[model samples]
Target chain A: MEKATEELIKETAKDIFFKQGNLHATTQDIADAAGVNRSLLNYYFRSRDLLFEQVYNEAVQSKRSQLDEALDADLPFREKVERFIDVYLRDMRKYPFKEAFLISEINHKDFVLKNKKKSAKLISFLDEIAAEMKKGTIRTMDPMHFLVNLFSMLSYPIIMSPLYQQLFNLSHTRYENFIDERKDIILQSIFI
Target chain B: MEKATEELIKETAKDIFFKQGNLHATTQDIADAAGVNRSLLNYYFRSRDLLFEQVYNEAVQSKRSQLDEALDADLPFREKVERFIDVYLRDMRKYPFKEAFLISEINHKDFVLKNKKKSAKLISFLDEIAAEMKKGTIRTMDPMHFLVNLFSMLSYPIIMSPLYQQLFNLSHTRYENFIDERKDIILQSIFI
Candidate 1:
């Protein structure tokens, strides 16, 4: 019973904080959303701040692990890059505000930085690119720039879709298709 | 004196609304920030919402015109693209939250969509891309896809810089430098 309640609280809290953009959600708001009493929140997570921290940490972890595993996987360089973009776009689509919420909370005093473990994951991705560059499969450029370009291509469309939709007068279907259309262009941009 | 008070109120309202993220800023907040009584805000703009609308409209107008004039100019295609990216990066730096803020307010129940004038501006940009495509200077693809790539490369980094900085361990200077390095690669990606 206690385990179920705790999981319920966490799921509800993630929905509220991440999906709903209720960064200021109080214990009552979360408890109410979860359909549990206020005391249950305290019993489960102790405080609103702690609940938020746990949720945010899990979100960041899950995202990093997704990328780390994809990049660290044994696959052709372009294939891995394509899979990375696909997973990222799907995640962004699922949690439309995830990136925005992350940006807002990234600098908060209570936000913990937990990136010491990511470097080990990044090395192989860089090495793969270096090998390709040596073979002239891709242009000789700083791997960091290549990574940044790849990420920028994937994320900006998702984040700024609303504005661009209006600018281009695109219907809802066209907007989604626009994102679906980026994989080829992004790969061509990365490889020579 | 009247004109000065109106300008002061508008400036304060923008600082409060956009920079400070004070979407719910009251008349009192604007008056306090501008060192004027709440009455002058209504006296000049008749309501806080009107002042906000005017400021938001002017911002969009100025931005569209900047792009319109730049694209319509008779510069070489690559040079024009470089200049546009430069101005865009400068603007994003000046108002880091402008795009985010615009996205949020763009869906406000009372928000007006004024994009009819922009199509005229965008036509020349599309024509230029088509010209390049015909000349084989750039690959043949959907003009829309080409544009989405161009914008995604330019914007995603600025919008999601905080997350990437933390993940990549970039200092402020390094982050800025990363954006500066993208221009050459982005142009290369667009043109053969």
Candidate 2:
């Protein structure tokens, strides 16, 4: 029962922060959202800051693992990218504000990644991108820029959806459909 | 003297919120940063929320004008894009957190943009991108995606610099140099 309650509180906090984009949510807010008393919430997490730290660390770990899973898969480079985009977009659709929340935490709170071991998977993926360039399958540039470009296209539109919807005069439903259409557009843009 | 003091408070708030990424800054924080007394700061802005609203509105206005200037220029489409990237990158280098701040304000604060007039300039720019696609100068896709891709490539790296610096194992100076080298790479990626 205790473990279940703890998980419930944490998940509720994540829902508020990642899905709702409420970076300023308080302990009481989490407690209220979770249908628990504030004292019980405190008993589980001790403090709001401590709860946020756990959530932040878990978010980073989950993202790294998602990248690792996609990059380490045994598939052709293009197929790997396609699968990665599918997985990433699905996740973003569920938690559209997760990236924005993570960015804000890092920017405003001086949060630093605790793990520093350079991912062998990411390095190998860069090499793969470079080899694809050599074969003229993709544009030749710094591999880092290639990765940056890929993620920029995938994540930026979702992160800035609110602003773009207004700027483009798109209704919410139309804007969502537009984003749903970008998977192919992104692939064609990347692979010449 | 009074007008100058008011302007100083607003600018100081902008510096703290946009440049420093200190979204939680209090009115006292702004006053101290401006090297003025709290009462003087309040005398001009009345309250922190009011001050933030003024700053936020001005930021949005400035960004719109910047886009209008770039998109309305008489240069060819490619050169116009080049100029937009250059202007945007220069602004981002100076205020790296501005976009992040704006997104956060919109997401968390229920802030609606006061202006609703569809930009004729941006509409025409989209038409230009479509024309370029017909001319085989760029990839053929939804022109909105073209703009999204362009802005995404331009803005995401800067906004997520802290995370990228860690992920790529780059020193600050090296990372900055890498970003500076991306203008040509972005152009190449888009122009085929």
Candidate 3:
């Protein structure tokens, strides 16, 4: 029961911070969201900053693990990218503000990744991208730019959805449909 | 001198919020950054919210005008894109956190754009993109996706610089060079 309560609190905090885009949500807010007494929350986490740090670390780890899984998957290059987009967009739909939260934390808190070295998976993924380029399947450029371009298209529209919905005059349903259409569009844009 | 101080406070707030990515900066922080007393800041803007409103409005206005200039320029489609990239990147280099700030405000504050309608300029630009597709100069996709892809490639790298610098193990100078190289790369990715 105690473990469940603690997990509830952490999950509630993630919902507030990641799903709702409320970077300024207070401990009281989390406690309210979790239906727990403020003292109980404090008892479990000690303080708001500690709670936030745990959530932040978990968010980073989850994202890194997702990337690693996609990169290390033994699939064709195109299929690998398709799998990556599927996983990434699934997470984005569930937690639209997560990337925004991550970026904000990095900007405001001087957050540093614990694993500073580039992962072997990522290095191999770059090599795979380079190999694909050699086959003239994708545009020839620095492998890093290919990665950047892939992530940029996949993440940016979702991150800026609030603003883009207004700018493009898209209803919520319409905007979602537009994003749904992007899977193929993105694939086509990359390949030839 | 009075006008100068007021301008100084606004500019300093912009520097803090847009350049430094300190979205949570207090009025006292802004005043300190401006080298002005809190009372002086209040004297000019009446309240911190009012000061923020002014800065936010100006940032939106400035970005809109820049886009308008690029879209409405008489240059060829390719040159116009090149010019847009140049201007957008130049502003981004100066105010790296501006888009993050804007998106956060929209998400957290229920900030509706003053101009909610799709601009005539943006519509024409979309038309222009469609025309380019017909001419076989670019990949065929929803014009909206085209715009999203363009802005994504342009902005995401800069916005995620703090995180990306660590993730990719890029030195500050090397990252800047990477971004500098993106203009040509973005053009190539867009134009067939």
* Highest-DockQ candidate: 3
lDDT of 2 at A60: 83
Q: State, as a TM-score between 0 and 1, how close model 2 is to the true structure.
A: 0.96
lDDT of 2 by residue, B86-147 (tens): 88988888887787778778866465665475699999888999999999999899999999
Task: Give the per-residue lDDT digits (tens) of candidate 1, residues B41-113.
Answer: 8889987678878988877776777667767768888788888888777776666656655655664344566
Ranking under TM-score, best-scoring first? 3, 2, 1
Candidate 1 per-residue lDDT over residues A71-124, each given as its tens digit = 876778778888898888788777766665566566333455665634777876
Model 3: how far is B156 from its true place, Å? 0.5
Best by TM-score: 3
User: Where does candidate 2 stray beyond 4 Å?
Assistant: A113-115, B113-115
Q: After superposition, how far is residue A170 of candidate 1 from its true place, in Å?
A: 0.9
Steric clashes per prediction = 0, 0, 0
Model 3 chain A: ten consecutive residues of lowest lDDT = A106-115
Better of 1 and 2 by DockQ: 2
Better of 1 and 2 by TM-score: 2
